[model samples]
Structures are given as C-alpha cells and as structure tokens.
Target chain A: MPTYLTQHQNRFLEELLDWLRIPSVSADPKFHGDVLRAADFIKDRLLEAGATLVELCPTAGNPIVYGEYMAGPDRPTVLVYGHYDVQPADPYELWTSPPFEPVIKNEKIYARGACDDKGQVYMHVKALEMMLRDGGLGAPCNIKFMFEGEEEIGSDNLGIFVKANKEKLQADVILISDTGILANDVPSIEVGLRGLSYHEVEVTGPNRDLHSGLYGGAVMNPINALCDMISSLHDENRHITIPGFYDNVADLGPAERAELAQAPFSAEAFTQSIGLPAAVGEAGYTTPERTSIRPTLDVNGIWGGYTGEGAKTVIASKAYAKISMR
Target chain B: MPTYLTQHQNRFLEELLDWLRIPSVSADPKFHGDVLRAADFIKDRLLEAGATLVELCPTAGNPIVYGEYMAGPDRPTVLVYGHYDVQPADPYELWTSPPFEPVIKNEKIYARGACDDKGQVYMHVKALEMMLRDGGLGAPCNIKFMFEGEEEIGSDNLGIFVKANKEKLQADVILISDTGILANDVPSIEVGLRGLSYHEVEVTGPNRDLHSGLYGGAVMNPINALCDMISSLHDENRHITIPGFYDNVADLGPAERAELAQAPFSAEAFTQSIGLPAAVGEAGYTTPERTSIRPTLDVNGIWGGYTGEGAKTVIASKAYAKISMR
Candidate 1:
C-alpha cells in the first residue's frame, strides 16, 4: 500500500469513530441535541476536506448537511445521496456494548451506525479529501453531497428540501451505497430497492388491566386480538392476505424468473448462517426474489401486559405492534 | 347496622390499609423481605384477633400463615383457603396511585390485591375478630384459616404443606370466599371455578440481535415467528387448534345448557363493560360457559425487541409469551 493511502485510511476510520460516538438517533426527541451536533460535524468535516459552498440546510426536521466540489463545466457531475442520522439504539439490553461506543470485534466494527450511512457516507467525504490532497490522482468530475438527517424516520423533511432546491442537485447520475451486499467476494449491485411503509396498530379491550381469571373468554384480550389480526395478514401459503394487497404486485414472466433464478444460493448454508432450521417465504419465489422482487411484511416489535418475572394472569387493556412492509 | 359493627368497620379498614402498605410482590425475588413481612403481619393479626392457635408454617416457598379457633371436634369444622401474597403490580403507570399505598377514590378502595383474596381474606380475619368481640354472633362452628403466600404464583409450596398436614387440616367442609358478588342488591355464587394451566414460551431465532435492514428477509425474526405461531394457535371459528385439545371435554346436555342459560346476562352490557365491540369464543358456548365451564387460552403477556421511544429496526433474537389455559 502507498504510505499516504495507509495514513489516509487510518485517519478516515478515526474520524468516522469520532462521528459514530455522537448517537445521532433522529427518531427520538431525547437525542435532539446529538442530531444537531452530527450535522455540524459533517459540515465542519466537509469544509476541512476543501469542499466549497458547504452549508447546513435546515428543514422542518433535522438539518441537512450539504457540500459541493466543482472540477469544471465539461466534467460529469455525480450527486451522492446519504444520511447523517441513524436508527434508535433500543432494546439496549440486547446490545453487547453501549451503542455509541464503537468497538471492533471479530474483524467487524460493532456500533449502531457502523456500516450504515455514517460509515458509508463518511468514506465519500474521505475520498473527496484524497482527491484534493493528492494532486496527481485528481478528480475529473464535479460532485455534490446531500446528507439528510431524517432518513431513519421516514425522511419526513427530505421531500420538501429536494423540491425547494432542485437546481443545486443536478447531476448525470445519483450514487448511493446505503444497501447491503451479499458478501465481500460477490460484487452484486442492487438495481432496485424496496420502498417502506411502516405502521403501528393498537388493540384495546378493557378500560384497565383486569384479572384474567375473572374476565377470560368474556371479552377480547388485546394481546390475543393483536396476534389474531397479525396472523390473518398472512395466509397458510405464507402469502399476504390484506385484500388487494398484491393487486399491483409486478408479475414477472417465467423467462424473467428463470433468468433471475440463475443466481446461486444454497438453502442449508443460508439458514445455517442465521442458525435457523429453515426459511419460509412466498411459495413460488427464490430467497433473493422474495426479498427484492416481492414485498414482505414483518413485525419489528410487540409488547403488552405483565411481561416481567413470573406471571400476573392479566388481560392487558392494550397491545401494540410496530409493522414494516418492504 | 348494629352499633358495635358500624364502629369496628372504620378500624377494620384502617388495619387492612396498613397491611396493604407492605409491598408483598411474591413473584420477584427483590420483594422477599416484604413477603416475609406479610406472613408475619398475618400471624400477628391472627394472634391479636384472639385465635387460639397461630403459627407461620414454613415450606419450600413463602410461609403459610395458619390460625384456628376450635369450638371442639364435635361441631362442624370449617377450613378457609386464602392467600396473603399478591401479584406483582407491574405496568405501574396504569395505577392511579402507588399500588402498595392503598387509596380510596370514587367510593372504591383501589389497590393491588384489594379485591383478589387479600381484601377477602382480611375480612375473614375481621370476622373472626367480630365473633370474639361480640361473643353472641358465632360460637356454633370450628373455624380454621389457612393463608398461603404463593397463590399469585403457582401455589408451589401449598401442595406439600397440605399433604404433610392432612391430619391437622381435617375439617367437615372447605369454605372459600375468594370471588366477588354482582351488586349490593343482587346475590350471586360461583359453584365451580375454572382451572388454570400457565405456560411460558421463548422463541429463539438468531444468536443475537441484528440490524433488520441488513438481515431482515434473510434470517428468521423471532418477533415475526412468535406472531406467526401465536396467530396459528386459533382457527377460523376461534377454536384452539392444539391437537386433541377438546378431546374428553364433557358435552353439556341440552337440559344442563338450559339451566345454565337461566343465569341472567345481557351480552350488550357484558361487552360494553369491557369496551369491546363484541365478545368472541367457541361458536356454540355462551360467555359464562366459555369463561367458567369451557376452557380457553389467552396471552397474559408478550414482549420482544425495540418497544421503546423510536424505531430500532432490529430482528430480535428472542421473543416471549405468557399463555394461560382456563
């Protein structure tokens, strides 16, 4: 490796580790200050990396970190899309370490935003730095970086920002490294990404938690009702049964399916990697197609009643589920 | 009301409130001292209430508070079954006041275990006091009060205690007042009680929590799996689908069904009281029959990942449910 390249790599990781320590969880109001600090950090880094026209674009939600670099008018323009915010670090007991405290274990960096946009987005800024630092391998292209801070929470402010600033984002093609790859060796590129529609349902029964022994079978239990409703979302064949849920689902012909099926996947190795006896999805599609071509519904979280030490035989008034569809 | 009877009611409520102040949550180990104090309270109260024999019966679990007022073996011996320990007051936010600090609001004495056996059992202790104080109200029967501390849990130690002390517990009949009445003007009685079989199931998928965006559709999510499994527990008609679940279930004769139907109940009032649109159970059974005679299953509690302020998008490793069969 070149001496400057090695030094740049070390500095790049160090800077990212510093950024990762901010805990910029956008969804929670408790981390409001931290989210703002993350935007400031990105803006300062972009300025230090010799980017011109760096600014914090405030929206209805968290501010967007914007920067630009111009090679020449004839150069191809590349617009990069990424986020400075991250998902909330919840179920904190499940995490091995404090989520904001980055740790490297088993040749992998373990943190809430590691390998996410924080890690991916920071690399591009570092690359821009390299082009400015090393004069020989200089950039021959104009680049624009738009890092939003509300992507984790449905990108609530991004649509307005994009519409209001259309001319500033003009480019030949947009670049994004937010999606995950299959493996280090398999150089797979995602041609399309699934859109997300998230929802939460609250099932209620009694006005207050009642003794189950006194009220069982007399009224609906919110937990049982929630479970029944969730179960009905999918049929016996593992197909979603939301009544016209699949009305507009694209139907690929057999020829197209066969072409997609050419991708290699072993069921045993796949399930083994996740410690599952088997994997089940739509009856007729491959695993890759089930995830990519087909939309899927999953329950991200569920809770109700006395989920504590032993048991309380309570018919809780409310049960909740956080559902995500992709 | 009689003069002395009306006067004693005030002090009686005060003493019960004092006893309720001890946080005797039996399910949690942290409340071990409180449980013991509850047992001691009962023993001291029994002695003060003029019981001839009072003792703390030690067992594998929390101790049993025993007291007797024998009017000789010739008279009818009535044994009372009750419990001193209370269920863990969880979801404490639902409470209008701290659970251990008994409160009276809107003509209702509200507290954990205020109605479920604790209040009922304490009334009996007061009844014994009344008999001793009045001397003319009850001298015809021999009474034995047996209060165990693990009834909120499985009553694990009661079986051993009962079996070992069979000779000492010899009585003509068992009288239990662990249930409630309809109203001050109405008289009601429960002929039989539903049996309970509580179970806890833990579903494990991956060895650790993973970012849902990375491994969502690839690996099994325990929350999704749990919802799937719980949803499958019932069928189209809301019948429990466990194999041979209804086997050996006694079929109630038409005459018996008619007799049961004679119990006055308005379906509208039942559902409205609990804030449910409708009541649901087996197709043929009535609400009373489903709750008391026929068996039913319900999830007392359920918990999994990321049930917090914002989204974690975690495919949790473990999911849990506390189910009870009645």
Candidate 2:
C-alpha cells in the first residue's frame, strides 16, 4: 500500500532471490560455509538499512545475526525475531524445479526458505529502510533485529544467546512472523504455542531373529511386543494412558474454549483435504481444540524385521519406534 | 558299522560334497541353472546305484528326480522321499565359509544343505549301492526314490506331481529322513508336523505424511493404528483372539500329553539357548506343547514412517506388518 514498496519491489525481489540461492541449511555440517555466508548477507543488509549496531554473534552452533536501530533513549522498543536458515530440501525429486534455484510463477516465488522466515525477515529490513530514506519520516521507536541461523534446527543456541544478552534484548514487545495467519485479507494470530518432546524406544525380545514356524508359538516376537506396548499407551476413549500425563496440563475455562471454537474451521473440508473418511480425535473435544489446546502422543516411526517385496516368516529380535509428545 | 560302509565312506562323503557345491537354492530364481544341475546330479547318482528306472519329471516349477529299484512283486514296497534343493544362504557374512563351497571343519561338513535333504538323499543312493554291490546282500524290498528340487520353496510343484502320479508313487511304507535325530547315538521320530499360514497387513491413514506438531493430536497415525490392530490379535493370556481359528484344531488327550511330557526337556536350557529372560507362551500350555501342538499368531515384521538415524516428527501415511500363524 506504500509508494516506496511499489517503486522498489523489483529490487527487493532480486535481493531475496539472491539470499535464497545460498542454500543455508544449518542442519547439515557440509553447509557450514554457506550458513555463515547467509549470516553475512543479513549483516550487510542490516547495515545498509541504516542500523547502527549490526554484528554476527558466535555460538556453539551457527551464529546469530543481531542488529539495532535506536530512535532515542525515551522511545519504546520492539524486538523483531526471525531466522535466516531453512529446513533441508530433501526428497528433492518432489519439487517441480530445483529448490535453491528460486523461480517466480503467478507472482509467487518458489524456494525452500522463500516463505518460512527469509521473506518475512526481508520485509522488516526494507520497511526500516523505507521509513529512514523513502520519506522525511524517521524511526518512531527503537527496533532490535535478531535473525538466528539455527531456528530450523530447534534453535539450540538461541536460548544461550538470549540468556547471555538479556539486557541488550530488552523491549516493550516482541514480534514474530514465524506462524501463518488464516488469510492475507482476514488477518489472525495464534495466542499460544505448543511445547514438544521427542523420544526413541526399542523393545528387545530374543537375541536373534528366529524362524516363525519353528518358534512362533513359544517365543514372543519383538515386533508384536512393541505393538502391544504402543497400543496400551492409549485407552478406549482415545486418552493417553500414561500415568500423570494429564496431571499438569492446564484446562481452559468454557469462555476460552468458546473463543477458540470461533476460529474458522470445517470438519468436512479438513477430512477431505487429508483424504480421510471422517475426522477423529479425543472423544470430548472438537478437532480444533484437539490440535491446539490438547497434548498428544504420536508414533512418528516404527520398524522391525523383514519389510521387503514378499513374505519372510521371521520373528525379529528387536523393534523400535520414535514417539513425539506435543 | 558294516564293512562295506566303512570301506567306501570316504568316496560317499566326496560324492555328497560335490553335490553340495551346486548352490541349488530353490528360493532364488538366479540359481535356476544350479537347481536343474542338482536334479541331474540326483538322477546320475540313483542310476550309478543300480536303479533300473530313473527320470526327471517336469512340472510348472523345478523338476522332480524319480527313480525305482524293483525287488520283485512279492516283496513290500518302500518309498524314500527327499529333496536335492537347499534354502538360500543369505546374510552370507554370517557363514564361516562360502555357502556353496563345502568345507570340513572339526569332523563336520559346513554347507547350507549339509544336514538337510541333500545329505540325507545322498545316503539313500549310497545305501542302495552298498546293498546291491557289497557282499551280495541284494535289495530286500521294492525301493522307490522321489527327490524333489522345490522343497525349500514350500514344495509347491511337489504337491501337484504327487496328485498327478499317485499310482506310480504307491508304496506300503514311506521313509523320509528330512527331520533330525535326538543325537548321533540316539534316534528319534516325529509323529506329526505343524501347518503354517502367513499374511501381510497394511494400515492407511492420511493420503500423505503430516507434520506431527500441526496435526498429531487430530490425525490418526497409521503406525499407531497398525500397532493397535496387531496387539488385539491375541488376548491377555496369549491365546489367539480370532473367531473360528481353533474350530478345527485337534486337542491331544491326557495320555498323549503325558507321553509328550516324558520326553527329555530342560526349560532353563531352552531359555538360555535363545538368550531370553524366560520362556513365555499360551497360558495353559508348556513350551514344548505350544511349539508343537497349540496354534499361534505372531507379528513377524512391522514397518512404517522414518526409521533412519535421529528423529523425524512425521505421522506416516501408511504402515505395514507381516503375520504368521502356526
């Protein structure tokens, strides 16, 4: 809606395409140099946007890019949080074009990190530049930018950096554009975020894989044992059976529940989108509440024994599963 | 031991070793030539042992080596059943020596089919030779030999061959050395054998893998669904829960059960041999009875989702399991 944004849109798009081509995937160590180069890109862009203090703060993992535009000592401050790195573009064959080679069709850029955080973070830098250079209007408030390079990898180092520099990061409010709104025209915001814990479990039975026909009746198969253990984690009512699992989970009052239910959702559309016959979840809660307000235990992966093209009558020695709780 | 057997024992072992080198693995199609060569070896050995009639009977799969030595019509007939094919030697690294290259180690021959029907079938050919050529001890009964080359692959073609040539295979008694003895000095015989049925199951949830953090509590994970299904196949007491599964199963009487219990058995040794904490089976049956008489259901294999290194928070679109019943 601003004249500055419309006039310099082509240049802004060019800058984003250049950054997207760096392949700054922090999860893989082979991309370490590219990750650092991506940080430098951010540092240069921040400096060009008239930020006074812009530096790359080192950590045990990838470094954090920090920049600041101080209006004055008396003005309220806003801390903007974002990341420069992206999740690995694996199963690359699924993409229509190469991942790092950004392509724009129908006015939408196609790339790994184009949408995630790079696009959003770029908007902040350009907005700051527009206010400082486009018009005579200067900064109305103090703004601190923290663009992390390890956000895609659970942000392992961001916590340490935040703790060590708490005074430097002080602000009246924090703004994060990591999550998406309902629509571009009808804006929406999430009030809360879920915490996650992941774990891997292994069940061992016999010492070696045994012939199913020779020992099936007498020995307990590790796969079957693992299945039995996993099945018991949830009760008949779809509630987690782990002791004290729900003891600390906070319960929202009826008013809050009503407010959450007001979010636009269609059970038919949700089921059809996922190609499920119907939606299923906790017996008492609706689908929206189940995804947002409730904790969940899901087996992300399970494997054991022969899984080839044909049948192999073998009782595997061990079975494993990866579980995640949200 | 007879003088003839003792005198030519070296030659007999040499002939058996040569046959074992053919690599007649019926399970793999890559060894099709080796399988046919194995059948030819059996046919030549039977003829060398003074058999009047020997032929390779053609079938849908591998051929069956049929030979006969008629000891006059007045004597009772004996049908000797065996196989020249061996099970595939896989995970080949586990073998001390090459599977197809026979080796003598510590007075025992090492090969895939050494103790199976190949060795046992060789003994029958050598015995017929010894009786006809040594000390003029001519055959005492009409002996018929039927060595199939598809026993390792469920004997698929053998059943069809038997049904088609029932009259040609007729005999007063059938002798099969396919099973093992209790010891070299102690002989043992099995009165019956167990029947087997195998199956593969698939559980499908969503059309595509979903992010656990976004849809975990709402969507049903296929791995968890498959585990739940597998766990319900047996009851708390380990008895199969399928209806009509045991309708045709026969129960052994108290007298037979007592006789079976009298056989030499050590629960401690059985448990220790397999490196299990303890032997577990159906609630009311002993380990021996469970393996031999009682029916069983086991999940031989289970697989789904990410089974690679580290963790992947994904709810898989599909999960699979292989089950076998005995």
RMSD of each: 2.0, 4.4
Task: Name model 1 segments beyond 4 Å from true.
Answer: A134-136, A264-269, B134-138
Interface Cα RMSD for candidate 2?
Answer: 2.5
Q: Clash pairs of candidate 2?
A: none
Quote the lDDT for A265 in model 1: 57
Q: What residue pairs are clashing in model 1?
A: none
Q: Model 2: per-residue lDDT, tens digit, A184-270? A: 564777778777777889998888777766677888888988999999999887899999999989999999999888877778877
lDDT of 1 by residue, B1-326 (tens): 65556877788788899888888888888998998998898888888787999999999889998899998768999898888888899898878799988999877788887886678889888778777765437556898999999988888888899999998898998978887554455577878887677899999988777666555565567887788788788777778899988786777899988888887766787777777788887777888787777877889999987787766566788999999887
Model 1 local distance difference test score: 0.83
* Interface DockQ of each model: 0.66, 0.51
Model 2 chain B: weakest 10-residue lDDT segment is B179-188
